[model samples]
Target: MSGGIHADTAPKPVGSYPHARRVGDLLLLSGIGPRIPGSDAIPGNRYDADGRLLHYDIVAQCHSVFANVRAVLEASGARWQDLVDVTVYLTDMAADFAAYNAVWQEYFPDPATAPCRTTLGITALPTPIAIELKCIAATGAGARR
Candidate 1:
């Protein structure tokens, strides 16, 4: 727990990192990508016969990305509502902005409770991943695990 005190009571981390760490009342999480359930390959990076990116569907990717984020939160004993702020990094903002918004609305439910966010359009990402999300959250009440 070099970064902070871990709060996860579940199994050991799936990777080389801690599941979740507590800093005061806040819990900062690592970025999450849309990787397959039991596989490390991220979705949406495959190419079609035309050499086009498969699943060019940003909406679907957005959902999967957040769903992965939700999994991390759940595994760490936190919930979506606890998220205070988030940052999204994208490969092409102009093209996928709308789709991203649509999926974000579905997950947020209420705009009032939505966390502050920053979205960036970059030329590339580590794994052809269209999007990646990192978030911060608060642990209320009996916060210890």
Candidate 2:
């Protein structure tokens, strides 16, 4: 629903789906990566000459992905504070967990107000990005569309 919600300011979805969809007061966002808008460039990710990822900064990816999530939420007529739950996926948990957690605390400093979170260490993602976020936000019913 929500008329195939799309955030023009955010990076394009890797697949054939809208940025988000609304069901009742909940807005469900698709997987959001740390790619730069328009170029799909992953922040802090260094690629080799053959386009293979050489290394990445988890802090940069964390900030970028969070910003991307905010864009989707705001474009969907919601705010960052409206987020109720988030599921994070990372390719290398053991290597990235501490840095990612530090970055997370920077954005969500208050545990009382921060959304419920679940982090999963996966094998890979569609792009070379190291992190991705799946979010659910609560929004009002009014759509100025």
Q: Model 2: which residue pairs collide?
A: none
Considering every candidate listed, which one attains the maximal lDDT? 2
**What is the TM-score (0 to 1) of candidate 2?**
0.94
Error of 2 at 80 (Å): 0.4
lDDT of 1 by residue, 1-145 (tens): 2363332332233457755576777778876666555665555566789866666557667877787777778876688888888999988898888888878888887877788888888898666678878788887775422
Global local distance difference test of model 2: 0.89
Query: Model 1 clash pairs?
Result: none
Model 2: lowest-lDDT 10 consecutive positions = 136-145
What TM-score would you give candidate 1 relative to the actual structure?
A: 0.78
| Model 2 Cα lDDT, one tens digit per residue, 1-145 | 4567999989999999999999888899999999998897888988889988889988988999999999998888889988889999999999999999999899989998888999999999999988999998877655211
lDDT of 2 at 34: 94
- Model 1: weakest 10-residue lDDT segment is 4-13
**lDDT (0-100) at residue 140 of candidate 1?**
70
After TM-score superposition, the amount by which residue 79's alpha carbon in candidate 1 deviates from its true location, in angstroms, is: 0.7
